[model samples]
Target: MTFYAFAKRIVSPILKKMYRVEVKGLEHFPEQGGVLLCSNHIDNMDPPILGVTCPRPISFMAKAELFNVPILSGIIKKLNAFPVKRGGNDREALRTGLKVLKEGKVLGLFPEGTRSKTGKLGKGLAGAGYFALRTNAQVIPCAIIGSYRIFQKVKVIYGKPIDMSELREKKASPEEATNLIMTHIQQLLNENR
Candidate 1:
């Protein structure tokens, strides 16, 4: 098995026992085709929680600074995580995301761009919307509820694909599309949390 699967195997049980991570609406994930998993960022464990809970393997983008650490860089790389420059336009990172989508893989992204200190949803960046507009991939809105305290009941809920048919023609800007995506995520958070 690949390292991604291997890591998930080891991490899954630990997350469950320690955090009691529960997932819902997994049917929203398509068995095949490219999919963009857009989620709210709350804690550092969010990515791994989503990864182990989701049915499919996810390729995620990490801040480029994380890649500078020796052992961490190697591990994240093997886990299908790529580096993305945070503050400015990183064309290479965008290109890598497009390539993943084109190959019909799942790309997990935190549209908010960073973890929220308040544990609330934040403004979304345009990257997720940009990918949806550039590809045929479906955008699934995900929300992770509960703090990452040990023995806490954390939940990961996946919502249905956001309809991007209207924006696919470039009629709407990426920021506008991001608003729609964030709206869906907020709804999920409100209902589930």
Candidate 2:
């Protein structure tokens, strides 16, 4: 196995045990293939929580600023994260994400762009939708609940995959597609609540 794949396999279980995490809907993941995991962001821990809980290596797009710290940047890179500038169009980051998807790897994206302090799902940016269309990858809507509460048990609900082929065929605008995906994520959160 590749280094990241092996490291992810070994580290996830240990981290889950240490954190006392509870996860569901792992079976919803495709046994093998590329996938775009679109998740709600409530806290800084959300990414690692979802990453370690799922049974595969998830390549996530982190803010470029975070990588400026030498030690943390190295660690994040080891964990299969790439950087994206926060305030503008990041073509390079988008290209890397697409390349990962095209290579049949999982790419995790926070559609909200940043954490939601209120614990309510925020409006999603169109990047996830755009990536899905560009790569024709399956979009898996994930909802993470109770992650904002300190030391509390967290729940991650993975909804069924949404096919992007139809969206591409209809020539749906990124805004429209993003809204649809966000609505689905909200519905998943409601179901868990």
C-alpha TM-score for every candidate: 0.98, 0.91
Candidate 1: deviation at residue 14, Å? 0.9
Which candidate should be chosen as best, given TM-score against the real structure?
A: 1
CA error at residue 152 for candidate 1, angstroms = 0.8
Q: For residues 5-94, write the lDDT of model 2, one tens digit per residue.
A: 676678777656665677778888876678999999988888878877777788999999989998999888988999999878899999
Superposition error at 79 for model 2 (Å): 1.1
The candidate that achieves the highest lDDT relative to the unseen native structure: 1
Error of 1 at 53 (Å): 0.5
Which 10 successive residues of model 1 have the least lDDT summed? Answer: 165-174
lDDT of 1 by residue, 54-160 (tens): 99999999999999999999999999999999999999999999999999999999999999989889999999889988999999999999988999899999999
